[model samples]
Target: MTKKNVDDYLQEGMYGTRLPKEAERKHFLGTLRERVILALTIGEVMSDRGLEKLETEMKKHPNSTLLMNGSVAYKFLKQERDLADKYKISHTTISNQEHQTEIGAVLTYDHAIDKEDIYLSNDEDQEKSDSVEKDDQKDQGIVERIKSWFS
Candidate 1:
Protein backbone atom coordinates (compact mmCIF):
# COMPACT_ATOMS: atom_id res chain seq x y z
CA MET A 1 0.00 0.00 0.00
CA THR A 2 1.31 3.48 -0.93
CA LYS A 3 1.28 6.28 1.68
CA LYS A 4 -0.78 9.30 0.69
CA ASN A 5 1.13 12.54 0.19
CA VAL A 6 0.13 16.07 1.26
CA ASP A 7 -1.16 16.86 -2.20
CA ASP A 8 -3.16 13.59 -2.27
CA TYR A 9 -4.67 14.42 1.15
CA LEU A 10 -5.62 17.94 -0.07
CA GLN A 11 -7.25 16.45 -3.16
CA GLU A 12 -9.19 14.03 -0.90
CA GLY A 13 -10.53 16.91 1.30
CA MET A 14 -8.69 15.60 4.37
CA TYR A 15 -5.74 17.99 4.72
CA GLY A 16 -7.05 21.10 6.35
CA THR A 17 -10.04 21.02 8.67
CA ARG A 18 -13.21 22.74 7.48
CA LEU A 19 -13.83 26.26 8.66
CA PRO A 20 -16.57 26.88 11.17
CA LYS A 21 -20.05 27.39 9.72
CA GLU A 22 -21.29 30.98 9.35
CA ALA A 23 -23.56 30.67 12.39
CA GLU A 24 -20.74 29.20 14.46
CA ARG A 25 -18.38 31.97 13.38
CA LYS A 26 -21.00 34.57 14.24
CA HIS A 27 -21.52 33.04 17.67
CA PHE A 28 -17.78 32.95 18.27
CA LEU A 29 -17.45 36.58 17.32
CA GLY A 30 -20.35 37.47 19.61
CA THR A 31 -18.61 35.74 22.51
CA LEU A 32 -15.39 37.53 21.58
CA ARG A 33 -17.22 40.86 21.70
CA GLU A 34 -18.54 40.17 25.18
CA ARG A 35 -15.12 39.08 26.44
CA VAL A 36 -13.50 42.17 24.95
CA ILE A 37 -16.06 44.39 26.65
CA LEU A 38 -15.43 42.74 29.99
CA ALA A 39 -11.65 42.97 29.62
CA LEU A 40 -11.91 46.63 28.60
CA THR A 41 -13.99 47.46 31.67
CA ILE A 42 -11.42 45.79 33.92
CA GLY A 43 -8.51 47.43 32.14
CA GLU A 44 -10.07 50.87 32.44
CA VAL A 45 -10.55 50.41 36.16
CA MET A 46 -6.99 49.14 36.54
CA SER A 47 -5.34 51.77 34.32
CA ASP A 48 -4.34 53.93 37.27
CA ARG A 49 -3.54 51.00 39.54
CA GLY A 50 -0.93 48.23 39.46
CA LEU A 51 -1.01 44.54 38.54
CA GLU A 52 -2.61 43.61 41.89
CA LYS A 53 -5.58 45.75 40.93
CA LEU A 54 -5.65 44.30 37.43
CA GLU A 55 -5.54 40.73 38.76
CA THR A 56 -8.29 41.52 41.27
CA GLU A 57 -10.51 42.98 38.56
CA MET A 58 -9.80 40.08 36.19
CA LYS A 59 -10.68 37.56 38.94
CA LYS A 60 -14.16 39.09 39.06
CA HIS A 61 -14.71 37.94 35.46
CA PRO A 62 -14.08 34.25 36.38
CA ASN A 63 -14.02 33.09 32.72
CA SER A 64 -10.51 31.72 32.14
CA THR A 65 -11.06 31.20 28.41
CA LEU A 66 -11.89 34.87 27.98
CA LEU A 67 -8.55 35.76 29.52
CA MET A 68 -6.74 33.76 26.80
CA ASN A 69 -8.77 34.98 23.81
CA GLY A 70 -7.18 37.44 21.36
CA SER A 71 -10.17 39.79 21.31
CA VAL A 72 -10.06 40.07 25.10
CA ALA A 73 -6.28 40.51 24.95
CA TYR A 74 -6.78 43.43 22.58
CA LYS A 75 -8.65 45.25 25.31
CA PHE A 76 -5.41 45.65 27.26
CA LEU A 77 -3.68 46.99 24.16
CA LYS A 78 -6.55 49.41 23.65
CA GLN A 79 -6.29 50.41 27.30
CA GLU A 80 -2.67 51.61 26.83
CA ARG A 81 -3.81 53.47 23.74
CA ASP A 82 -6.56 55.17 25.70
CA LEU A 83 -4.10 56.06 28.43
CA ALA A 84 -1.73 57.55 25.86
CA ASP A 85 -4.56 59.64 24.45
CA LYS A 86 -5.56 60.86 27.89
CA TYR A 87 -1.99 61.91 28.65
CA LYS A 88 -1.53 63.39 25.15
CA ILE A 89 1.33 60.98 24.56
CA SER A 90 2.16 59.24 21.29
CA HIS A 91 0.77 55.76 20.71
CA THR A 92 4.29 54.60 20.00
CA THR A 93 5.12 55.38 23.60
CA ILE A 94 2.88 52.47 24.57
CA SER A 95 4.07 49.94 22.05
CA ASN A 96 4.10 46.15 22.11
CA GLN A 97 7.57 46.32 23.65
CA GLU A 98 6.14 48.04 26.72
CA HIS A 99 3.36 45.49 26.90
CA GLN A 100 5.87 42.65 26.71
CA THR A 101 7.95 44.19 29.49
CA GLU A 102 4.90 44.43 31.70
CA ILE A 103 4.06 40.80 30.96
CA GLY A 104 7.60 39.75 31.85
CA ALA A 105 7.47 41.62 35.14
CA VAL A 106 4.15 40.04 36.06
CA LEU A 107 5.34 36.55 35.19
CA THR A 108 8.49 37.04 37.26
CA TYR A 109 6.39 38.10 40.24
CA ASP A 110 4.16 35.06 39.80
CA HIS A 111 7.10 32.72 39.62
CA ALA A 112 8.54 34.22 42.78
CA ILE A 113 5.27 33.66 44.58
CA ASP A 114 5.08 30.03 43.42
CA LYS A 115 8.58 29.20 44.58
CA GLU A 116 8.87 27.23 47.86
CA ASP A 117 11.58 29.47 49.26
CA ILE A 118 10.09 32.92 49.80
CA TYR A 119 13.40 34.71 50.02
CA LEU A 120 15.12 35.39 46.70
CA SER A 121 18.53 35.06 48.41
CA ASN A 122 20.44 35.31 51.68
CA ASP A 123 20.00 39.09 51.32
CA GLU A 124 16.63 38.66 53.03
CA ASP A 125 18.53 37.49 56.13
CA GLN A 126 18.47 41.15 57.18
CA GLU A 127 14.85 40.65 58.23
CA LYS A 128 15.93 37.85 60.55
CA SER A 129 18.60 40.07 62.07
CA ASP A 130 16.11 42.86 62.59
CA SER A 131 13.76 40.53 64.46
CA VAL A 132 16.65 39.32 66.66
CA GLU A 133 17.53 42.94 67.46
CA LYS A 134 13.95 43.65 68.48
CA ASP A 135 13.95 40.64 70.82
CA ASP A 136 17.28 41.77 72.33
CA GLN A 137 15.81 45.22 72.97
CA LYS A 138 12.78 43.70 74.69
CA ASP A 139 15.05 41.63 76.99
CA GLN A 140 17.34 44.55 77.85
CA GLY A 141 15.12 45.73 80.77
CA ILE A 142 15.07 42.24 82.26
CA VAL A 143 18.83 42.00 81.96
CA GLU A 144 19.23 45.33 83.81
CA ARG A 145 16.86 44.27 86.60
CA ILE A 146 18.75 41.01 87.10
CA LYS A 147 22.08 42.85 87.26
CA SER A 148 20.70 45.37 89.81
CA TRP A 149 19.25 42.59 92.01
CA PHE A 150 22.56 40.72 92.07
CA SER A 151 24.55 43.94 92.84
Candidate 2:
Protein backbone atom coordinates (compact mmCIF):
# COMPACT_ATOMS: atom_id res chain seq x y z
CA MET A 1 0.00 0.00 0.00
CA THR A 2 1.26 3.53 -0.82
CA LYS A 3 2.13 5.70 2.16
CA LYS A 4 -0.23 8.65 2.87
CA ASN A 5 1.35 12.05 1.99
CA VAL A 6 1.51 15.05 4.30
CA ASP A 7 -1.38 16.76 2.49
CA ASP A 8 -3.54 13.65 2.79
CA TYR A 9 -2.78 13.36 6.50
CA LEU A 10 -3.57 17.06 7.01
CA GLN A 11 -6.89 16.76 5.18
CA GLU A 12 -7.84 13.67 7.16
CA GLY A 13 -6.95 15.41 10.40
CA MET A 14 -8.95 18.51 9.43
CA TYR A 15 -12.03 16.49 8.53
CA GLY A 16 -12.74 13.05 9.82
CA THR A 17 -13.52 10.32 7.31
CA ARG A 18 -17.04 10.68 5.98
CA LEU A 19 -19.54 8.23 7.42
CA PRO A 20 -22.54 7.12 5.43
CA LYS A 21 -26.03 7.85 6.64
CA GLU A 22 -24.76 10.21 9.33
CA ALA A 23 -28.19 11.65 10.10
CA GLU A 24 -29.67 8.20 10.51
CA ARG A 25 -26.72 7.23 12.69
CA LYS A 26 -27.27 10.28 14.89
CA HIS A 27 -30.97 9.51 15.30
CA PHE A 28 -30.43 5.80 15.98
CA LEU A 29 -27.86 6.43 18.73
CA GLY A 30 -24.56 5.95 16.87
CA THR A 31 -25.51 3.02 14.64
CA LEU A 32 -27.18 2.86 11.25
CA ARG A 33 -30.89 2.00 11.24
CA GLU A 34 -30.28 -0.96 8.96
CA ARG A 35 -27.68 -2.35 11.34
CA VAL A 36 -30.02 -2.15 14.29
CA ILE A 37 -31.87 -5.24 15.41
CA LEU A 38 -33.96 -3.42 18.01
CA ALA A 39 -34.37 0.02 19.53
CA LEU A 40 -36.18 1.01 22.75
CA THR A 41 -37.61 4.32 23.84
CA ILE A 42 -36.49 6.02 27.03
CA GLY A 43 -39.84 5.41 28.71
CA GLU A 44 -39.80 1.77 27.67
CA VAL A 45 -36.31 1.31 29.08
CA MET A 46 -37.18 3.06 32.34
CA SER A 47 -40.36 1.08 32.88
CA ASP A 48 -38.84 -2.17 31.65
CA ARG A 49 -41.67 -2.26 29.13
CA GLY A 50 -39.51 -3.62 26.31
CA LEU A 51 -37.11 -5.64 28.42
CA GLU A 52 -38.31 -9.00 27.16
CA LYS A 53 -38.15 -7.86 23.56
CA LEU A 54 -34.65 -6.50 24.04
CA GLU A 55 -33.49 -9.72 25.65
CA THR A 56 -35.01 -11.80 22.88
CA GLU A 57 -33.28 -9.72 20.24
CA MET A 58 -30.03 -9.95 22.11
CA LYS A 59 -30.36 -13.73 22.16
CA LYS A 60 -30.95 -13.77 18.44
CA HIS A 61 -27.99 -11.52 17.70
CA PRO A 62 -25.50 -12.63 20.27
CA ASN A 63 -22.59 -11.03 18.41
CA SER A 64 -24.31 -7.65 18.26
CA THR A 65 -23.43 -4.74 20.50
CA LEU A 66 -25.89 -3.12 22.90
CA LEU A 67 -25.62 0.66 22.73
CA MET A 68 -27.43 2.56 25.46
CA ASN A 69 -27.91 6.29 25.68
CA GLY A 70 -25.62 7.55 28.39
CA SER A 71 -27.89 10.51 29.02
CA VAL A 72 -30.38 8.20 30.68
CA ALA A 73 -29.89 7.29 34.31
CA TYR A 74 -27.69 4.25 34.73
CA LYS A 75 -30.32 2.50 36.82
CA PHE A 76 -32.66 2.42 33.87
CA LEU A 77 -29.96 1.08 31.54
CA LYS A 78 -28.31 -1.33 33.95
CA GLN A 79 -30.90 -4.01 33.37
CA GLU A 80 -30.20 -3.96 29.65
CA ARG A 81 -26.45 -4.11 30.26
CA ASP A 82 -26.99 -7.14 32.45
CA LEU A 83 -29.08 -8.75 29.74
CA ALA A 84 -26.28 -8.14 27.27
CA ASP A 85 -23.86 -9.76 29.66
CA LYS A 86 -26.12 -12.79 29.86
CA TYR A 87 -26.00 -13.08 26.09
CA LYS A 88 -22.25 -12.33 26.14
CA ILE A 89 -22.74 -9.35 23.86
CA SER A 90 -20.51 -6.31 24.19
CA HIS A 91 -22.29 -3.17 25.33
CA THR A 92 -21.45 0.52 25.19
CA THR A 93 -23.08 3.75 26.36
CA ILE A 94 -23.09 6.53 23.76
CA SER A 95 -23.04 10.15 24.82
CA ASN A 96 -22.69 12.72 22.08
CA GLN A 97 -22.32 16.29 23.22
CA GLU A 98 -23.64 17.68 19.94
CA HIS A 99 -26.53 15.27 19.44
CA GLN A 100 -28.99 13.46 21.60
CA THR A 101 -31.56 10.86 20.58
CA GLU A 102 -34.85 9.83 22.16
CA ILE A 103 -33.81 6.23 21.64
CA GLY A 104 -32.85 4.68 24.95
CA ALA A 105 -31.03 1.62 23.63
CA VAL A 106 -30.01 0.00 20.38
CA LEU A 107 -28.96 -3.57 19.55
CA THR A 108 -26.73 -3.24 16.53
CA TYR A 109 -24.46 -5.24 14.29
CA ASP A 110 -21.18 -3.80 13.02
CA HIS A 111 -22.12 -4.22 9.35
CA ALA A 112 -25.24 -3.30 7.47
CA ILE A 113 -27.90 -5.99 7.83
CA ASP A 114 -30.53 -3.64 6.34
CA LYS A 115 -33.22 -4.86 8.70
CA GLU A 116 -36.60 -3.48 7.70
CA ASP A 117 -37.89 -3.08 11.26
CA ILE A 118 -35.81 -2.47 14.37
CA TYR A 119 -38.50 -1.64 16.88
CA LEU A 120 -40.03 -4.10 19.30
CA SER A 121 -43.25 -5.80 18.30
CA ASN A 122 -46.44 -4.63 20.00
CA ASP A 123 -47.83 -8.13 20.52
CA GLU A 124 -47.75 -7.74 24.30
CA ASP A 125 -49.60 -4.47 24.01
CA GLN A 126 -52.08 -6.13 21.66
CA GLU A 127 -52.62 -8.99 24.12
CA LYS A 128 -53.30 -6.53 26.91
CA SER A 129 -55.93 -4.77 24.83
CA ASP A 130 -57.50 -8.08 23.95
CA SER A 131 -57.70 -9.01 27.62
CA VAL A 132 -59.36 -5.70 28.38
CA GLU A 133 -61.94 -6.37 25.67
CA LYS A 134 -62.63 -9.80 27.10
CA ASP A 135 -63.16 -8.28 30.56
CA ASP A 136 -65.64 -5.81 29.11
CA GLN A 137 -67.51 -8.63 27.40
CA LYS A 138 -67.67 -10.58 30.65
CA ASP A 139 -69.14 -7.57 32.42
CA GLN A 140 -71.73 -7.14 29.68
CA GLY A 141 -72.68 -10.81 29.88
CA ILE A 142 -73.21 -10.59 33.65
CA VAL A 143 -75.42 -7.49 33.22
CA GLU A 144 -77.48 -9.19 30.49
CA ARG A 145 -77.98 -12.31 32.65
CA ILE A 146 -79.14 -10.16 35.59
CA LYS A 147 -81.59 -8.30 33.37
CA SER A 148 -83.05 -11.58 32.04
CA TRP A 149 -83.58 -12.86 35.63
CA PHE A 150 -85.36 -9.59 36.59
CA SER A 151 -87.63 -9.90 33.52
Candidate 3:
Protein backbone atom coordinates (compact mmCIF):
# COMPACT_ATOMS: atom_id res chain seq x y z
CA MET A 1 0.00 0.00 0.00
CA THR A 2 1.23 3.51 -0.81
CA LYS A 3 2.23 5.24 2.39
CA LYS A 4 0.39 8.42 3.36
CA ASN A 5 3.23 10.92 2.99
CA VAL A 6 3.69 14.33 1.34
CA ASP A 7 1.94 13.14 -1.81
CA ASP A 8 -1.25 12.63 0.17
CA TYR A 9 -1.03 16.23 1.26
CA LEU A 10 -3.31 18.64 -0.53
CA GLN A 11 -1.06 21.47 -1.70
CA GLU A 12 -3.21 24.55 -2.22
CA GLY A 13 -2.23 27.71 -4.12
CA MET A 14 1.44 27.85 -5.22
CA TYR A 15 3.17 24.51 -4.56
CA GLY A 16 4.41 21.55 -6.52
CA THR A 17 1.63 20.08 -8.62
CA ARG A 18 3.45 16.96 -9.71
CA LEU A 19 2.97 14.05 -7.34
CA PRO A 20 6.44 13.20 -6.08
CA LYS A 21 7.43 9.70 -5.01
CA GLU A 22 7.64 9.14 -1.27
CA ALA A 23 11.43 9.14 -1.34
CA GLU A 24 11.59 12.39 -3.29
CA ARG A 25 9.12 14.03 -0.97
CA LYS A 26 11.09 12.88 2.04
CA HIS A 27 14.34 14.23 0.56
CA PHE A 28 12.75 17.59 -0.24
CA LEU A 29 11.26 17.79 3.21
CA GLY A 30 14.58 16.95 4.81
CA THR A 31 16.38 19.67 2.85
CA LEU A 32 13.72 22.24 3.68
CA ARG A 33 13.82 21.25 7.33
CA GLU A 34 17.58 21.65 7.46
CA ARG A 35 17.38 25.13 5.92
CA VAL A 36 14.72 26.10 8.41
CA ILE A 37 16.70 24.74 11.34
CA LEU A 38 19.81 26.65 10.23
CA ALA A 39 17.80 29.82 9.96
CA LEU A 40 16.31 29.35 13.42
CA THR A 41 19.59 28.47 15.05
CA ILE A 42 22.26 30.71 13.54
CA GLY A 43 23.10 34.40 14.07
CA GLU A 44 20.92 35.19 17.00
CA VAL A 45 21.84 36.64 20.36
CA MET A 46 19.67 35.05 23.03
CA SER A 47 19.94 34.27 26.70
CA ASP A 48 21.45 30.89 27.59
CA ARG A 49 18.04 29.84 28.85
CA GLY A 50 16.33 30.91 25.61
CA LEU A 51 18.95 29.19 23.47
CA GLU A 52 18.63 25.99 25.46
CA LYS A 53 14.85 26.14 25.22
CA LEU A 54 15.09 26.67 21.47
CA GLU A 55 17.40 23.70 21.11
CA THR A 56 15.06 21.54 23.18
CA GLU A 57 12.07 22.68 21.13
CA MET A 58 13.93 21.98 17.86
CA LYS A 59 14.58 18.42 19.02
CA LYS A 60 10.87 18.08 19.74
CA HIS A 61 10.14 18.68 16.06
CA PRO A 62 12.87 16.88 14.19
CA ASN A 63 10.86 17.04 10.99
CA SER A 64 10.34 20.77 11.36
CA THR A 65 12.72 23.78 11.44
CA LEU A 66 10.76 26.46 13.29
CA LEU A 67 10.73 27.25 16.99
CA MET A 68 7.06 27.47 17.94
CA ASN A 69 5.62 30.98 17.79
CA GLY A 70 8.98 32.60 17.14
CA SER A 71 8.90 35.63 14.86
CA VAL A 72 12.55 35.05 13.99
CA ALA A 73 11.79 31.46 13.08
CA TYR A 74 8.91 32.62 10.89
CA LYS A 75 11.19 35.12 9.19
CA PHE A 76 13.65 32.37 8.27
CA LEU A 77 10.86 30.08 7.13
CA LYS A 78 9.51 32.82 4.88
CA GLN A 79 12.96 33.34 3.40
CA GLU A 80 13.33 29.62 2.74
CA ARG A 81 9.82 29.36 1.31
CA ASP A 82 10.48 32.24 -1.05
CA LEU A 83 13.69 30.63 -2.23
CA ALA A 84 11.88 27.33 -2.73
CA ASP A 85 9.20 29.01 -4.75
CA LYS A 86 11.73 30.95 -6.81
CA TYR A 87 13.71 27.80 -7.57
CA LYS A 88 10.52 25.82 -8.28
CA ILE A 89 11.36 23.45 -5.49
CA SER A 90 7.66 23.02 -4.71
CA HIS A 91 4.21 23.93 -5.90
CA THR A 92 2.81 27.31 -5.06
CA THR A 93 0.81 27.33 -1.85
CA ILE A 94 -1.02 30.11 -0.03
CA SER A 95 0.58 28.81 3.12
CA ASN A 96 3.90 29.83 1.58
CA GLN A 97 3.21 33.30 2.84
CA GLU A 98 1.34 32.37 5.99
CA HIS A 99 3.36 31.32 9.01
CA GLN A 100 3.24 27.61 9.78
CA THR A 101 2.42 27.04 13.44
CA GLU A 102 3.06 23.33 13.35
CA ILE A 103 5.33 22.15 10.56
CA GLY A 104 6.68 25.60 9.73
CA ALA A 105 6.10 26.30 6.03
CA VAL A 106 4.59 23.27 4.37
CA LEU A 107 6.73 23.07 1.23
CA THR A 108 4.95 21.41 -1.64
CA TYR A 109 7.94 21.32 -3.97
CA ASP A 110 7.41 21.68 -7.71
CA HIS A 111 8.34 18.26 -8.99
CA ALA A 112 8.43 19.08 -12.66
CA ILE A 113 10.58 16.76 -14.73
CA ASP A 114 13.51 18.90 -15.82
CA LYS A 115 14.78 18.70 -19.37
CA GLU A 116 18.45 19.43 -19.92
CA ASP A 117 19.15 21.72 -22.88
CA ILE A 118 22.78 21.16 -23.77
CA TYR A 119 24.01 23.07 -26.82
CA LEU A 120 27.32 21.30 -27.44
CA SER A 121 27.54 17.58 -28.06
CA ASN A 122 30.26 15.65 -26.17
CA ASP A 123 31.18 13.75 -29.34
CA GLU A 124 31.65 16.99 -31.22
CA ASP A 125 33.86 18.32 -28.41
CA GLN A 126 35.99 15.18 -28.44
CA GLU A 127 36.38 15.33 -32.23
CA LYS A 128 37.48 18.98 -32.06
CA SER A 129 40.06 18.20 -29.35
CA ASP A 130 41.39 15.22 -31.33
CA SER A 131 41.76 17.34 -34.50
CA VAL A 132 43.56 20.09 -32.56
CA GLU A 133 45.96 17.59 -31.00
CA LYS A 134 46.74 16.02 -34.39
CA ASP A 135 47.47 19.46 -35.89
CA ASP A 136 49.73 20.34 -32.93
CA GLN A 137 51.68 17.08 -33.33
CA LYS A 138 52.16 17.67 -37.06
CA ASP A 139 53.40 21.18 -36.38
CA GLN A 140 55.83 19.86 -33.73
CA GLY A 141 57.18 17.24 -36.18
CA ILE A 142 57.64 19.91 -38.84
CA VAL A 143 59.55 22.10 -36.34
CA GLU A 144 61.79 19.15 -35.39
CA ARG A 145 62.58 18.44 -39.06
CA ILE A 146 63.51 22.09 -39.61
CA LYS A 147 65.76 22.03 -36.52
CA SER A 148 67.51 18.80 -37.75
CA TRP A 149 68.15 20.38 -41.19
CA PHE A 150 69.72 23.45 -39.48
CA SER A 151 71.91 21.21 -37.31
Candidate 4:
Protein backbone atom coordinates (compact mmCIF):
# COMPACT_ATOMS: atom_id res chain seq x y z
CA MET A 1 0.00 0.00 0.00
CA THR A 2 1.17 3.52 -0.70
CA LYS A 3 1.92 5.93 2.17
CA LYS A 4 -0.87 8.22 3.25
CA ASN A 5 -0.75 11.75 1.87
CA VAL A 6 -1.65 14.87 3.83
CA ASP A 7 -4.72 15.48 1.61
CA ASP A 8 -5.98 11.93 2.19
CA TYR A 9 -5.52 12.29 5.94
CA LEU A 10 -7.47 15.53 5.98
CA GLN A 11 -10.26 14.08 3.90
CA GLU A 12 -10.56 11.02 6.11
CA GLY A 13 -10.52 13.11 9.26
CA MET A 14 -13.19 15.52 8.04
CA TYR A 15 -15.52 13.06 6.27
CA GLY A 16 -14.60 9.76 7.89
CA THR A 17 -13.32 6.85 5.80
CA ARG A 18 -14.29 6.93 2.17
CA LEU A 19 -16.59 4.10 1.15
CA PRO A 20 -17.90 2.94 -2.18
CA LYS A 21 -21.62 3.11 -2.83
CA GLU A 22 -22.15 5.92 -0.36
CA ALA A 23 -25.51 6.88 -1.88
CA GLU A 24 -26.74 3.30 -1.75
CA ARG A 25 -25.51 2.95 1.80
CA LYS A 26 -27.37 6.06 2.83
CA HIS A 27 -30.53 4.73 1.19
CA PHE A 28 -30.22 1.36 2.94
CA LEU A 29 -29.72 2.92 6.38
CA GLY A 30 -25.91 2.74 6.43
CA THR A 31 -25.76 -0.77 4.96
CA LEU A 32 -25.21 -2.08 1.45
CA ARG A 33 -28.05 -3.35 -0.72
CA GLU A 34 -26.29 -6.67 -1.20
CA ARG A 35 -26.21 -7.13 2.56
CA VAL A 36 -29.91 -6.53 3.01
CA ILE A 37 -32.23 -9.50 3.55
CA LEU A 38 -35.43 -7.52 3.59
CA ALA A 39 -36.36 -3.84 3.24
CA LEU A 40 -39.64 -2.06 3.95
CA THR A 41 -40.82 1.38 2.88
CA ILE A 42 -42.37 3.91 5.23
CA GLY A 43 -45.81 3.11 3.90
CA GLU A 44 -45.42 -0.60 4.48
CA VAL A 45 -44.05 0.03 7.94
CA MET A 46 -47.01 2.23 8.84
CA SER A 47 -49.48 -0.29 7.47
CA ASP A 48 -47.34 -3.07 8.97
CA ARG A 49 -47.65 -5.17 5.87
CA GLY A 50 -45.66 -8.39 5.48
CA LEU A 51 -44.33 -8.20 9.02
CA GLU A 52 -44.67 -11.95 9.26
CA LYS A 53 -42.29 -12.21 6.34
CA LEU A 54 -39.92 -9.85 8.13
CA GLU A 55 -40.06 -12.04 11.21
CA THR A 56 -39.37 -15.07 9.08
CA GLU A 57 -36.36 -13.35 7.56
CA MET A 58 -35.12 -12.44 11.01
CA LYS A 59 -35.37 -16.04 12.17
CA LYS A 60 -33.55 -17.23 9.09
CA HIS A 61 -30.77 -14.66 9.33
CA PRO A 62 -30.09 -14.80 13.03
CA ASN A 63 -27.04 -12.58 12.83
CA SER A 64 -28.70 -9.94 10.76
CA THR A 65 -29.32 -6.49 12.23
CA LEU A 66 -32.55 -4.58 11.93
CA LEU A 67 -31.91 -1.01 10.71
CA MET A 68 -34.85 1.32 10.99
CA ASN A 69 -35.09 4.81 9.53
CA GLY A 70 -34.96 7.35 12.36
CA SER A 71 -37.09 9.68 10.27
CA VAL A 72 -40.07 7.46 10.94
CA ALA A 73 -41.98 7.94 14.14
CA TYR A 74 -41.10 5.43 16.83
CA LYS A 75 -44.77 4.48 17.16
CA PHE A 76 -44.74 3.11 13.61
CA LEU A 77 -41.42 1.33 14.08
CA LYS A 78 -42.18 -0.06 17.56
CA GLN A 79 -43.51 -3.43 16.44
CA GLU A 80 -40.40 -4.22 14.41
CA ARG A 81 -38.16 -3.09 17.25
CA ASP A 82 -40.06 -5.38 19.61
CA LEU A 83 -39.59 -8.27 17.20
CA ALA A 84 -35.86 -7.65 17.09
CA ASP A 85 -35.74 -7.64 20.89
CA LYS A 86 -37.78 -10.84 21.05
CA TYR A 87 -35.37 -12.64 18.73
CA LYS A 88 -32.28 -11.12 20.32
CA ILE A 89 -31.19 -9.52 17.09
CA SER A 90 -29.14 -6.31 17.16
CA HIS A 91 -30.98 -3.34 15.70
CA THR A 92 -30.47 0.38 15.32
CA THR A 93 -32.43 3.34 14.07
CA ILE A 94 -30.20 5.33 11.69
CA SER A 95 -30.74 8.80 10.37
CA ASN A 96 -28.98 10.86 7.63
CA GLN A 97 -30.14 14.43 7.87
CA GLU A 98 -28.73 15.29 4.45
CA HIS A 99 -30.69 12.64 2.65
CA GLN A 100 -34.24 11.37 3.10
CA THR A 101 -34.76 7.63 2.66
CA GLU A 102 -38.10 6.16 1.71
CA ILE A 103 -37.23 2.81 3.26
CA GLY A 104 -38.47 2.50 6.80
CA ALA A 105 -36.76 -0.72 7.89
CA VAL A 106 -34.12 -3.16 6.77
CA LEU A 107 -32.92 -6.63 7.84
CA THR A 108 -29.24 -6.89 7.06
CA TYR A 109 -25.99 -8.58 7.93
CA ASP A 110 -22.65 -6.86 8.45
CA HIS A 111 -21.04 -8.42 5.38
CA ALA A 112 -22.49 -8.66 1.94
CA ILE A 113 -24.92 -11.52 1.37
CA ASP A 114 -25.34 -10.38 -2.28
CA LYS A 115 -29.02 -11.22 -2.64
CA GLU A 116 -30.53 -10.07 -5.93
CA ASP A 117 -33.69 -8.61 -4.47
CA ILE A 118 -34.39 -7.45 -0.92
CA TYR A 119 -37.75 -5.78 -1.11
CA LEU A 120 -40.99 -7.70 -0.64
CA SER A 121 -42.67 -8.97 -3.80
CA ASN A 122 -45.84 -7.54 -5.27
CA ASP A 123 -47.90 -10.51 -4.20
CA GLU A 124 -46.87 -10.12 -0.59
CA ASP A 125 -47.40 -6.38 -0.70
CA GLN A 126 -50.80 -6.84 -2.26
CA GLU A 127 -51.80 -9.43 0.29
CA LYS A 128 -50.76 -7.23 3.17
CA SER A 129 -52.46 -4.16 1.74
CA ASP A 130 -55.62 -6.19 1.32
CA SER A 131 -55.44 -7.30 4.92
CA VAL A 132 -54.99 -3.72 6.06
CA GLU A 133 -57.99 -2.67 4.04
CA LYS A 134 -60.08 -5.40 5.61
CA ASP A 135 -58.98 -4.31 9.06
CA ASP A 136 -59.97 -0.74 8.31
CA GLN A 137 -63.34 -1.94 7.09
CA LYS A 138 -63.90 -3.88 10.27
CA ASP A 139 -63.02 -0.85 12.39
CA GLN A 140 -65.44 1.21 10.31
CA GLY A 141 -68.16 -1.31 10.93
CA ILE A 142 -67.64 -1.07 14.68
CA VAL A 143 -67.69 2.72 14.53
CA GLU A 144 -70.97 2.58 12.60
CA ARG A 145 -72.46 0.31 15.24
CA ILE A 146 -71.44 2.70 18.00
CA LYS A 147 -72.85 5.62 16.08
CA SER A 148 -76.18 3.82 15.65
CA TRP A 149 -76.36 3.17 19.39
CA PHE A 150 -75.66 6.84 20.19
CA SER A 151 -78.26 8.03 17.66
Note the residue pairs that clash in candidate 2: none
When summed lDDT is taken over every stretch of 10 residues in candidate 1, the lowest stretch is 103-112
Give the Å error, residue 43, model 3: 44
90-140 in candidate 1: lDDT tens per residue? 322112321222111110111112323211123236767889999999899
Q: Between 1 and 2, whose lDDT is larger?
A: 2
RMSD each, Å: 15.2, 5.3, 17.4, 9.4
TM-score per candidate, chains pooled: 0.22, 0.73, 0.28, 0.73
Q: What are the runs in model 1 whose C-alpha is more than 4 Å off? A: 1-119
Candidate closer to the true structure by lDDT (higher is better), 2 or 3: 2
Q: Where in model 2 is the C-alpha error above 4 Å?
A: 1-20, 111-117
User: Once superposed on the true structure, which residue ranges of model 3 sit more than 4 Å away at CA?
Assistant: 1-7, 12-120
Which digits, one per residue and each the tens of the lDDT, describe model 3 over residues 29-85? 323322332222223312111233334433443443232223334554455444444
- Candidate 3: RMSD over Cα atoms? 17.4
Tell me how candidate 4 scores on lDDT: 0.91
- Candidate 4: tens digits of C-alpha lDDT, residues 19-87: 999999989999989888999999999999858889999889888899999999999999999999999
Q: Relative to the unseen true structure, what is the C-alpha lDDT of residue 105 in candidate 1, on a scale of 0 to 100?
A: 11
| Model 2, C-alpha of 53: deviation from truth (Å) | 2.6
Backbone clashes under 3 angstroms, per model = 0, 0, 16, 0
Span of 10 residues, lowest total lDDT, candidate 4? 116-125
